[model samples]
Target chain A: MCDLVVTENGSVVGTEKGRIYVKLHDEELTTFPSESLESITLMSNSTVTTYLIKQCLTKNIPILYITQNGKYLGGYRGVTTNKTSLQRAQCELFNTEFSLNFAKKIVTSKIKNQISLLYRHKSCDDVSTDIESMNNLKKRILFCDSIDAVRGYEGRAAAVYFKGLSRLSGEFAFDCRSRRPPLDPFNSMLCFGYSILYNLFYSLIETKGLNPFFGFCHADGDGHASLASDLMEEWRPLIVDSSVLSLIRKKMILKEQFTKAEDGGVYLNKDAIKTFRAYIQNKLFQKNHTVESVEEKKSYFDFISHQVSTLIRAILQKDFSLFE
Target chain B: MCDLVVTENGSVVGTEKGRIYVKLHDEELTTFPSESLESITLMSNSTVTTYLIKQCLTKNIPILYITQNGKYLGGYRGVTTNKTSLQRAQCELFNTEFSLNFAKKIVTSKIKNQISLLYRHKSCDDVSTDIESMNNLKKRILFCDSIDAVRGYEGRAAAVYFKGLSRLSGEFAFDCRSRRPPLDPFNSMLCFGYSILYNLFYSLIETKGLNPFFGFCHADGDGHASLASDLMEEWRPLIVDSSVLSLIRKKMILKEQFTKAEDGGVYLNKDAIKTFRAYIQNKLFQKNHTVESVEEKKSYFDFISHQVSTLIRAILQKDFSLFE
Candidate 1:
């Protein structure tokens, strides 16, 4: 695990006796050794003392500063190690057979997981018709000649997938995958879960020295961890969606646990968010069977690192099949 | 993942298409396909439709019921899967050399990981004196005469170890390792994290078809997953402690996130618990270095199942070293 620190709301991380410590709100304190740390995330209102900065620079740990809402402020790192050549290859390989194959595999994997989720909550009668259409969509995406076509099929399948989600009914209904402020409780959980998921995938991508902004399916965007997105697609239903269904249906999260904004945006009450996060974490790490080759029953938790490592390996070998 | 559903605060989980659907407050609905779900957790004050119960029983899915505070409230499982022979072997093996070796190896692994964590975060000067004692304790435990002796050293070393943790000053401090309504935030986090860890390990034990109450390090206890506890020891410091330190030091958790009980107990405030759980979940599944035979940079997560599988293999082969 990387020893990364992220401080917020006027907490300053500094060094004491060669170990990292934090002084918060001018009173509270905490310390840690920086040996295993790979980076530090400094949110708005967070401060990094000069000594801590120097040690991070010397040790080559990147310090990422972002806003309270998680906008990327900037990053601090020692410049001796760079990946300019690798980034060039990432762009070059985006439209190649490698990217095409990887994207197809991930999309197919995602659809299959989505179908499986539908089958879980739906009766034989509920999903019986949709399953054939989904299976057809999977094959259509698998045979698409271009990334754009794959994206098209994916969008269509998502429409079907999201509609089927409505069948969950009661407290856990998804009416199209709404975003931004998350217009519904289910959407709020999904959005919240995905945000944590993105950060996790981004961290792994950064550690592997890959360009998170360049991905096969997702084109380059302003400060986006696009590659992380590409890697995360196959896992969305498997990890986040499954957990959402389990948590809500299992009654771990309820309707009263959410608050609606004046704009009709649904947000988890202060209490539900914790329960959501904790439950999601448990769900992610809890062991289960996956298509991935593992020693025994494996938790979806390792898939982030595992898949990212596979991406790096595939890129280095010019073999996209290695991914996923 | 298990099909078990925990219902509390008024939620009902039912079946739709061989899938479990949860209805909350009679208005909200969430569904999960029962495929891959091994069981359902039924908590108190929850209702299950007759059709759903019949489906679960017909499908042979066990429904484990617990209290809101998480006490075992019995279970609704399918016809018994007898383990007469395995239970006999487990009981006979508990006090044998097999148990002794498995217990010793786990202690050694735990000590090694602890030393690594200390060296990682400890100021060289602070740990200089403490390191020698820890090293000697390691050796002493290695050569201890009996299981009780090994337990003794583990306890003595804990005294020195807990003292060293004080070096992590500021808000991230633990006076001692406390449980059962942990008295400090750190301890509370530990207790909560361990609870989830126990469930994860217990699930694996059940899957392995081993008796959870029979174990090597921990003797049989009333209603305890003794084998899970034994398996959990090597991992507690390796996984949980490291994450606790990282999360607290990273400032991902804050001081204001806790509440003071009128009786002077510490508990995670409404918000901190979510962040704490989510962070721990991420930490548990966050990829890290571990001593396991694998293809890539493996996380300690797989070790949960890996070690259990090893335990099963060792018992079958009568070879104890397989556990480590």
Candidate 2:
């Protein structure tokens, strides 16, 4: 269940007889049995051997590629699952009445979480009106008949949520949401956190044997893992936004720790990225993150696994009530 | 379009500055530009760095894995394409009337090639009756309305073709086609060769952005690349069987170069596999193999590429007449 993060630059990672070893020059740095690994994250310039890749694929341990500056590149999701029945079920369920219900659930749950986050900062700012507006939109999503309608409600809620977030910011300058080249440090952090959450969902959804491209709420697009984008909506505010808030509110990241790129995009600097990653790891794994719908206390990792499992079971049983 | 095969036992392959380099214990073995490689085949025990893999994947160069004894164990087929329209076309055409016609064509083409190979050895043995029986089955396949019936005819033709192959074998003891634990060397060679052919088609099919699991002739089974298995049928006798026969006729492999395993399966020994691989490479790449249907003179490499292109075009166009 351990996520192995290899940040050692210029080192080679190899596997021999099922044991993974790291070496620099002619010196063996470290070795461990690969059976305990859940995922491998390469965060720096390092080399990985084919034998290790073979072992990872055999164990279904996804190898995630992330840049040293905290941007998430794509990952090798190992082999596509051989579970054709599950894949067929997923494809068949898309665009059905069942899918619309699931889409509404995702939107409502996401807005509900957004409202909760806004409520957390109630003492710091007057976010009650925005929260009320989002609550109304969340209710309206239940009556949505089409995928586009659900997305429309979700988009409206995002407008209120982002505005509410700007008011809650104690020191950071925040405005409307911007991306591609996020204008402010606040939006940059949000974009970076969202990318990480999206890729996390991507790996989990594929591991559950569902087609990531075939989604319920999101329209199908070429080269897009639409389903991952759909599923991560409910968790974005809870996992990513909360973590970003913690880092900002605790004054753990200073304003000087960000750089404006040539394209006018603000990005986290190298030292700040290290602090950000450490904080995220602590929040996702060490802290108590619970599923409010299930009323169970667990780590965020378990929470993500539960959501993926629930989606697959709902698809398998042809029922959306399980999602509710 | 060169396929790089790495056979060094303990060498490590890495890429830097767009150049691929192989090393062993700090001593550089070889270096080349990464852009020149079309595919990579790992034949012996070796380690490949992640950088090389990333480059290969970005370039769409499939990395194939083969055992020291020539068993084709899967490969890394890189990323699935972003071509949603092409994928949609493939899925929509599956199990349609078009698929039935396509399935029949695959069987007929396969049987035709099998009959051609048998004819090549006509002077070696009296295989006239087996050839005629296969010819009758081949013609009947075109009239098949269902995939099961086409497969039934294919099975009957295979019975005749394998018997014909046994009769044509000059020195190898091949009574019948035995697999799993092939009882004789000839059957073992056939099994090994077919595995390679199947994987080759698997990589090619995925490279074309088609789902390899959804197939035409073969029934979709869990975990099986049915489309690869179906498509390779047309090329099996032409590529695998003919190369195997040439190995036997030219006395390239000796009888003593085969070992009987503890499970009663006869397999090519270490040295025999090398000779067999070299001969197959020569026949596939160096020989002027002509496509009789198009009256085109090309290498077996181009022949395989042409077949894959034909199948993809047929799937995209929704017209099996193109295959004809």
Candidate 3:
């Protein structure tokens, strides 16, 4: 019921007598009962046996891959989630007014989460203008006639929000949000954590029997998990951004642990990657009270799962109200 | 340039200093240069490192997994082949008159291949009646207006084809074509070889950026690579059946190498699996003169790749004439 993160470069993973075991340089590092594993994340250059692949597929545990710099490199899927009806419904929803509305709801919630994070750090940094801008942008989403307009507002709000976060970074300089190869440590950690969160959302969406390529918010395109990307948008500030900010404020991941490439792209080293992965896993599994259900504390995993379930229901019933 | 078949149980595969290495129980068994690998196939309980997976992905080498009994469990894909226009065209061709015509061509070609195989073994077995029936079925396919009718004719043709194959089996028992758990040794080898061939087609179909699920010849369903199945139909007799027949006739795989389960299902054991895998690999890569271009020799792999490319052209142009 937990994520097994294997970050060692030369480690080999395989199953032995129904138990999953990890080895590094021929020495057995550890073994876990298959039941204890919810999913597995392999970072850098670790190896896995076909036996482990088979066991993961049989147990429905996804095996995700991340590059050394923390870019999500997809994963080995078991039997594809194959609900034709759900996919049909999802495809039908695309390019409709309902899709536009759904996109607006997602964008607004994302902005709201960004505003909430900014307000929480208001005492430490003057984020009043960013918060106000985000709030106004959230309202403007209601008037968005197209997905492009919603995307435009979301992009503008992200710019204002990231600028506020830069002020909150203190010692860690974050001039602007940079991806591919993050320009700064903060951006590096943010991109890394976002990649993890994106994969998490991707797995959950596929598990819910929804086509990951079709989406209401993100436009359908080749080679992109549009639906998963769409779902991750709302949770970016709530999960990844929050986890990254906590790591920076707690000094858990130092800037020295990150190395700059010749092209000036920052990347977390092996040990720092381990720390970041552990922190993200803890953040995902930790339970916290929500604004709507203050009496019931829910883990980030539970919240994301609930959102996916609600999205499926919305698609099936042609009703976005319950999801919103 | 050839497939790296990893059949050793407990063997760990990884890359060390840019060379792909296999270690068993920490003993260095062998290594290969990345450029020397075309694809990878893992059988039984072998292990592979994430580094190898990354290497394979980066090199665009596909890793296929097959169970001990030779059932294809699937493989780890790198970046998905993403030509949106190709996929769109493929989906649009489904359930159309073109689809029906295209399906007829596939079925006819399949039946013709069956007849050709029967004729090749005519001197050894009395397959005249079966060959005649297949010819009639192939002709019937041309008049068929529906895919189901084409499938019906195809099934009947396969029934006749397998019967003739059984007559040609000599010492091996092949009462009928039994799958899931093949009922006899010949059926076991046939199924195993077909599984490999099916996966080969599946990978090629995806690499061409055509939707493997939306197939003109086969009805789409849950968890099935219908397009792969559709394309594999024509190649079954040409590749798998031909290989299995040669193996049986040549005694390349002995009958004792097969084992029967408690429920009376037959499967190839570990050693026989190696022999079968090697034979199939040889058969796929072996170049020989073909009927269409008798002066020029083409490998089976070339034939399959050409078929896939032709299929793409057919879909794009909305024309099946060139493909047929």
Tens-digit lDDT track for model 3 on B147-166? 89989998898888888988
Predicted candidate 2 versus true structure: per-residue lDDT over B17-75, tens digit per residue: 87877788879987788777667778766776766665566566777776665555556
Candidate 2 residue pairs in clash (backbone atoms < 3 Å):
none
In model 1 chain B, where is the ten-residue run with the lowest total lDDT?
B73-82
lDDT of 1 by residue, A1-324 (tens): 344445345676766665777777776477666675656765435556644554555455666644333334334433223343444455567668887887788888889989988888776238767777988999988678988889889888888888877776564766678887788888888887786667657655655556565678876453456777888887788778888877876788888888887877787775676576567667666777566455677667666667777777778778776765
Task: Find the number of clashing residue pairs for candidate 2.
Answer: 0
At residue B101, what lDDT does model 2 achieve? Answer: 88
Q: Which candidate is the best by TM-score?
A: 2
Q: Report the lDDT tens digits of candidate 3 across residue range A111-217.
A: 99899888988999788988887888889889889999999999999999989988888899677889877898888988888888877877788666776777778
Candidate 2 on A223-284: residue-level lDDT in tens?
67788888888888987888888888999888898999899889998778777777776767
Worst 10 residues of 1 chain A by lDDT: A73-82
Query: lDDT of candidate 3?
Result: 0.79
Ordered list by TM-score, greatest first: 2, 3, 1
Against the native complex, each candidate's DockQ, computed on alpha carbons, is: 0.01, 0.40, 0.41
Misplaced by over 4 Å in model 2 are A15-33, A69-80, A287-296, B16-19, B24-32, B69-80, B287-297
What TM-score, over all chains together, does every model reach?
A: 0.45, 0.92, 0.90
